[model samples]
Target: MTDRHDVVIVGGGLVGASLAIALVRQGVEVGLVEAAPAGQMPAVFDQRNLSFAAATVNALTALGVMQQLRTPTGPIRRIHISRQGDFGRVRLEAQDYGRATFGQVVVARDFGEALEARLDGLSGLTRYRPARFVGFAPDEAGHRALRIADAEGERTLHARLVVAADGTRSAVREALGIGVDEHDYGQTLFVARVRATQAPDGTAYERLGDDGPTALLPRGDRHWGVVHGVAREQAESVAALDDAAWLARLQRAVGWRIGRLVASGERSAYPIARVVAQRLVADRAVVLGNAAQTIHPIGAQGFNLGLRDALTLAEEIARGDDPGATSRLAAYAARRREDRERTLAFSDGLARLTANPSPLLKPVRSAGLVAMEAQPSLQAFLVGGAMGFRGDVPALCRGEAA
Candidate 1:
């Protein structure tokens, strides 16, 4: 007989690592495989950040990852959404909604390293670094056999369940015969860390221009993470410009809300696409995170939604006698449909609408923003929904304050 575990997780990125930690806490023996052993750690001065909604924060807290973060985490007191060449705008304030803050922003590298440290201390968990998933097979006995290859040789692991958190181009999902519907926006997203001439003061801003959506999200020490989308044809030109020229162009589109956008660090650009798998499950194997669905980064919902997937799966595993049973998988799929559809539609719609240069959309968008901003009840719903508080939210996402 070979070595066996309760679950085998393929991928050790943010979502997969968190899932492993959560399951291990429940006393389930877990085996995690990562292609890169001791993946490159974040540099000291790195400042890329992620905007965490309240629900996402709650999820992290439950996994004990938040407790280790120790940087200048700032609350998102307000959000400003506006379109250039339009006379209307929408504003959401936490104070108006009787909440302390809408969300908080944390440096991505910091958060990732902290989670890695926690994973190191985890018990009942076996980690296979510098290893990759070559293939997997399953039987009617409700067990999965995984073939993993590494520097040493090949080994097989048997588990009651298998999770594919391997990202957008998932090998496991492909092995399960699951296909993804991909929508290429014909655009690219540029992300960078910058020192704004003005203080963000915990305010997140989004500028929707004919070009695309440009967001300035706050980070620690007055730094900001700027994410902007540009057409594929235009992205190269934008990325080719010097820092000074780039800052000038960015500030012109965003207005003078946060003062001059000064120094910028290493910049990275990636093609944007919306990917949704036809099915999320196959036998005893299931896909989560980017494997099941990969959406545009419009509202920064990609990773947040993935976190919810992990949390929901954890809840089921923690509560059920047989975690990988057919009934349990069905329940997970049912519970995730509403939120997934809502987010997918919102992201795709926003991407298409804002990228449209049509003169006819001007009036409609203007009026819509104005109305959305003025209605208190409607604003409340938008705020809550944007912060990942809607649909069938799991208990851990509520920040139980334990």
Candidate 2:
């Protein structure tokens, strides 16, 4: 006999695990399948810094995941954005919008561990670890039959709604023949932890140059999280630099805004790209997180956007009797349309404009920054986006019971 579940979420990463927890709270039977072993951590839970928007913080709090964090998180009181050779810069303060802080930055590993801890206590949830999703077949009873291979060997399962929370190269998505609009930016991002001469004062800096954007986000009381973008052609050399040499190169790229970089941690680099699925829903299956869309890391919108996807989809599932109903899935897609489009456009446009080397465009970029700082309306618009206030926010995101 095949095991049956109301919802079977593939890829037990941040988004997938969140969805499972949300559904289980709504009295829905959820089965979570993860490719990794029981004790192994997913790649998403790396040493990188994750900036959680206010909306995301609200949702996580409602889910009881925020309070469970064992690691410290740094508050983002203000954001300073500028171009290396530009005359103007923009500063956005959370106090201007009547908020304590715009967002909080947490180490990805810490956040992931928090989510995992919460998963263990959730009722009505089953976890299949060290499992691989072989394939799926359509069932006439409005469900999908899934095949899984794990340490215990092979088994069959059925799910009314199958969610793909896998990473960029989603196996479920590929099996369904979904295509993506992929754009390789020909740039690589180097991320690490660094100690600066000046102490972190709850401020985040985004310095854009001809090569790419370099961001320094407050990680804790003493260290700052660094994301340095390098051209693909020179990424290897930059990654090969010694700690002293790397610190020197980063100082040259970002200037003295954060003071000198004194110490650095292990550096990791990955190619940057913009990937959006051709479609979000198909039959009884739907995609979320990096599986549905992968945006540039310029504004730190990727994970926040994925969290919204999970929350919104969970809302839709909780409201209806049939979790796999086409109408519910359609509503999920419709609700995400506006937010997804705006975020993708903003991230992509920022990466292109800031990374452009044209001398003529420098003034244009600088003028835009100056205008944003001078105009309250423009600042509000951006602040809203940064806080994840776009479109029809779910009840959980609004700090309500869901």
Candidate 3:
């Protein structure tokens, strides 16, 4: 069997789904493929919480997805960063920027459900659920022919463009003959939702030391999402501990930044790394989200970057550009250059710099933090960039109506 569309999107996760929404809003016909079955809304996927920047909120509002998010979205009015044994720290507050908050923290499940609801409400989207990509072929015309399989049999899908928003280990990226630069940081991120004795007060905290960087992000309730980086060997030991033992370890490692940790929800861990693709587009196909780049989860730039990718591509397609044209693809790559490079370098550099345990570097790091706190312009720039406003932002990110 065969199907046809103007655009075929692989991997119907947050990024792919968002891309589909954006394209559909632009009057583009979209075919979305996902390995997950229809009506299969998995359990909240552990206790992951997303920190959304103001720019992200603007983009989602433009996409009409924000209205569907269910939960008490907590605004991030302050960002506190410190080093365990350092003498200086950087404190960023929305008061300095004249904004309510740099961003908000949203539960993963709520965000997913909101996105899924938006997908469902989309009028011109064709979804291929529980379908896996078997292979792809790029023709001389710059169109891609994809082989996908489901319960019945294999089928061919032809589209002007094929987007691989699958994930870090993307099958579409592999089949497209694109290479990636992979870095294993030798660190694992332990994530969980914990009820803290202290109220969040709309603040996000990060403390760096020899073990690694640990962050506490505000959730809807009095709960805070805890992400602690540790050696791979120690991650398993930490994950296996009982509730009391885990709380004790968390308290000792995190100290009383948010006061005592009373209880914890589901706990999970992910290996940290910096994965960058050699190229963003290949022939008539391109990669998005983690398939294109995967950064350390330190600053929470992973999904924000992916969402930007989707928004950019959607804008390109909406501009009446030929989806399969080399010029159009090149333009998309050009538009993403500054933001992509800056984000990758910043995240990677911060991870490496903080992981250094040299006594000499500590003073330099502390001085840098102090400088950031003292300079308003510098703080605004950093905060703005962190909130997804770096480089040439799409109209949607500019708070313009979609």
Candidate 4:
């Protein structure tokens, strides 16, 4: 096997890249394996907008990752959530809770570019691009012998830990023999950048309808990031719509919240599903990000949760000399349990409950919304989660070193 590194991360996307940054900053030896070619962004880096929870912003800020962004991010100062044809609504202002803002929004493509720029500055890090993780086997040195493939051929690299940040359908996780409990939301999401007659005022809107939830998030470019969810059977029809027709449909769903949806930019669609790995750690290998849990995006919790995974794992690694020791991995799993479970349940439940139009559930749903509006404690609970302070938070989340 090749000379060992402290850790070898497969799937250098958002979570993996962040993990590499975190680990390297903490003085850990790191090898980053990315499937994309050199000088190119990964596939996950696209036009989709990522909502950075307060904690995420803090952690990335601590790593100096935010400074690398070429574009400014939109701050979420207020949030509005309401159901179509429903009697209740919930409005929250960060100022009401003594916070300046709940979070910020960054385009996935730009965020990816920023992550690349940040990663480049770390001269000690090893990057294997245009490469794929073939498989891993036990090493005599108590590490994993990873088979990595590139343009030349396959080569073996040993590492104390192997991370499957490979996303929802992780080949690394599968190679580790990890099974997942999966849920298909039966909903397809359409994403785009749109401009409204009235410019955004730093407020994000979630208009829930029987079809699904249509969200309008403030974007730094004075436009809005739109994520419109619809039933699977209707997805094709919506996908085939012309830009004008698409904006019209989006306008109908969003109502007058953001004013007229006058124009739209590039649009894309994909089905949403929840895939939770049954276990986080197996021997010297572990999963992070979507490999561990792929929750619905109704509340923009997916990436934030995955980022927490990276931060928590990084914290654990810093806590021990042997990064892949069984005791350390177990501790990492323990620290992640509460946050992971709560986030997964929150995202899955919110998506199902809000999109469900059953008359019986309507009153309960409305009552819950009303209570959230009237009860400060309840709203506190929500803002706390959205701000990334709910459970066992990593040091980076608290704006401290890991």
Candidate 5:
């Protein structure tokens, strides 16, 4: 059997789902293929908390994705970044920059539920749930043929544009003949919800070191979300620790920043790796989200960057008749070039620079932090990127429809 659509997106995770919402709103026909069955969320949709930049909130709000959240989200009004044993630190307040909040933190599972809800009964959307992407066949003029398998059976899907949002180990990307630059940071990040002696007070804290970076983000339930990074060699031992032992380790790593963490919820661990696609577009297809690039989680730019990719592509498709035209794909690539490159560099550089154990980098790191704290221009630049206002931003990122 064969199906047809304006766009066929593989991997209906966060980015693909967002793109569907955005494109469907523009009257585009979309086929969303997801491996997970309905009401049974994938492993990717877990209890980890995500730090949404302000621009992300704007874009998501514009797509009507934020309105369906079941749980409350915590706003980040302040950010505190310092290196372990460093003499200087940088503190940024959204109010000082004429903004009420930098961004909101939403639990990954809650956001996944909200996305599923928002996708309910949407026009111009055909969901192929519990479907697996087999591979791509020959192209038919401007359209590409996709082989997909589901409960019913195998079928062919013809799409004007095929988007691979399948994530870092993207099978669709491999079929599309796109190469990636991979980097293993040798760090494993363990995340969980924890209670501290002092409440979060709307501040997000990050302490960087070669021993591994520790971050405490505000959560909706008056608890802080802790992300403790450990060296790759020690990940197994760290993951096997009891809750009490883990909390104690966290307390030691972060000091008394948010006070002692007295308790913790369930824990999840993910190994850190950086993967950047050589090209964003190939033939009549393209990649989005982690399929296009995966950065170090230190700056929390992974999803934010991918969300921008979806929004930008949506903007291009909305403004043009040929959604899969080379011109349109080129335009999307062009629009994303500066933002993607800059954000990737920013995250990668921060990860490497902060984690370097060499004694020589300490002063340099301290000076950078001190400079950011003292100079309004430096702070503004930092805040602007954190707000997702960098490069050729799409209209949706500014709270406007494309």
Candidate 6:
């Protein structure tokens, strides 16, 4: 006899786990399969800083996941954007929008640990640890028959809907023959935690220069999380720098906005890229999270976008219809179209425009920022996008149950 579930989520990362919780709460039988063993942290859940948009926080709060976080999070009360050498500067404050804060920044590892802590408590949800998804086939009943390999060897499972929440290199997406538009930015991002001379005071800084954008997000009370983007050719050399040298380089790139960087933590670097799947849904399977689309991390939209993907799909599944029905998945894809397109464009455009060294374009970019600062409507638009308020807002995002 084959094990079965109403929905089988193929990845146990943040989005997949969140989706499983959402579905299980609705009384849907969910099976979560992860390649890593239980309690093991993946690279996605490292020391990198994760800026959760306000909408994302609401959604996670509604799902009861936010309360599980053991580590402290830094509130982003204001965002300061500027260029290396330009008169253009834009500042957005949460109070301007009648909110206490725009977003919250948490270490990725802490958030992952919170998600892991709640996984076992979810009713009607089963977790398959250290399991690899081998393949899938269509069953006679028009469902998905999944083959998963674990310590006990290959086992067959069936699901009404097979969700691929796997990371960028999703096997399920590949199995479905889904094509993607991939762009390697030829840049690398170095992330680290550093203590600055001045207290964070709930301010986040985004500095764009000829090299790339350097973002310093508030981490804890005394520490700030640094995301320094550098050319791919020089990434190795930059990453090889000692803590003092790295801090010095970061200080020069970002200026004296945050004061001297006194202490630093372990640094890690990864190449940056933009990837969007041609199709989000296929047959009885659907891809979510990084599996569906991987955006540039400039605005910290990647995980927030993925969280929305999970919640929206959950809403569709909660409709009590056939989870994998063509119409259902189609609706999910349609609902996500506008948000996905807009976010991809915004992130991609920002990465390109900010990193472009064309002196001619510098003033144009600065002028745009200056204009946005002067226009209340334009500022609101920017705030809305930053808060993850695009397209049809989901119930969870509004702090309502799905």
- Candidate 4 per-residue C-alpha lDDT over 266-365 given as tens digits, one digit per residue, 9 for 90 to 100: 8889799889999999888889999999888988998899999999999889888989999999999999999999988888889889888899999888
Whole-model Cα lDDT per candidate?
A: 0.83, 0.91, 0.85, 0.90, 0.91, 0.89
Q: Candidate 6, which ten residues in sequence have the lowest lDDT sum?
A: 135-144
lDDT of 5 by residue, 1-402 (tens): 999999999988889998999889889999999999987987788998899999999999987889999888999999999988788999999999899999999999998988999999998999999999999877798799999999999999999999999999999999988999999999999999999889879999988989578999998889998899999999999999999999888888888877777899998999999999999998889998999998998877888989999999998888788789999999999999999999999999999999889989888988999999999999999999988999999898988756
Residue pairs in clash, model 5? none
Residues 1-402 of candidate 3 have per-residue lDDT tens digits of 888888999998878888999999888889999888877753433358888888888999888889998778878999999888887888988877778888989887788888898999677799988899999754535457999998888988899999998899999999988999999988988888888779888999988877678898988787888888888778889888999998888888778988889998878888887888999998888898999999998788988988999898888887765776777788899999999999898888888898888999998888888888888887877887789988878888888865
In Å, residue 224's CA in model 5 sits off its true spot by 0.6
Error of 3 at 398 (Å): 1.2
Each candidate structure's TM-score, on Cα atoms with residue i matched to residue i, is: 0.96, 0.98, 0.97, 0.98, 0.99, 0.98
Off by over 4 Å in 1: 42-47, 138-140
- Say what the RMSD of model 5 is: 0.8
Residue 248 of model 5, lDDT score: 87
Candidate 1 whole-model C-alpha lDDT, 0 to 1? 0.83
Per-residue C-alpha lDDT of model 2 across residues 37-148, encoded as one tens digit per residue = 7778888899999999999999999998999898778899999999888889999999988999899999988988898889986889989998989998557587888888
Instruction: Give the distance in Å from residue 141's predicted Cα in candidate 2 to where it truly belongs.
Output: 0.7
Question: Which 10-residue window of candidate 3 scores lowest in summed lDDT?
Answer: 38-47
Q: Which predicted model would earn the best lDDT?
A: 5
lDDT of each residue in 1-402, candidate 1, tens digit only: 245788899988878888898889888899998876776652321445688888888778777888888777768889999988987888888888788788888887788777887898688999887888888745537688988987778888888889999998999899888999999988888888888778778789999877678998877667888887788899999989999988888888888898887798888887888889998777877899989899988878888888888888888787777778888888888888888888888888988887788999988888888899888887887887788887888777887632
How far is 179's C-alpha from truth in model 5 (Å)? 0.5
Compose the digit string of candidate 6's lDDT tens values, residues 1-402: 378999999998879988988888788999999878976975578998999999999988887788999988999999999988778789999998899999999898998888887777778988888999999855859579999999888998899999999989999999989999999998999999999889899999999877678999997657999999999999989978988899899999988888888999999897988888999998889998999999889888999999999989989987756899999899999999999999999999998998899889977997998898899999898889999999977888977765
Candidate 3: which pairs clash?
A: none
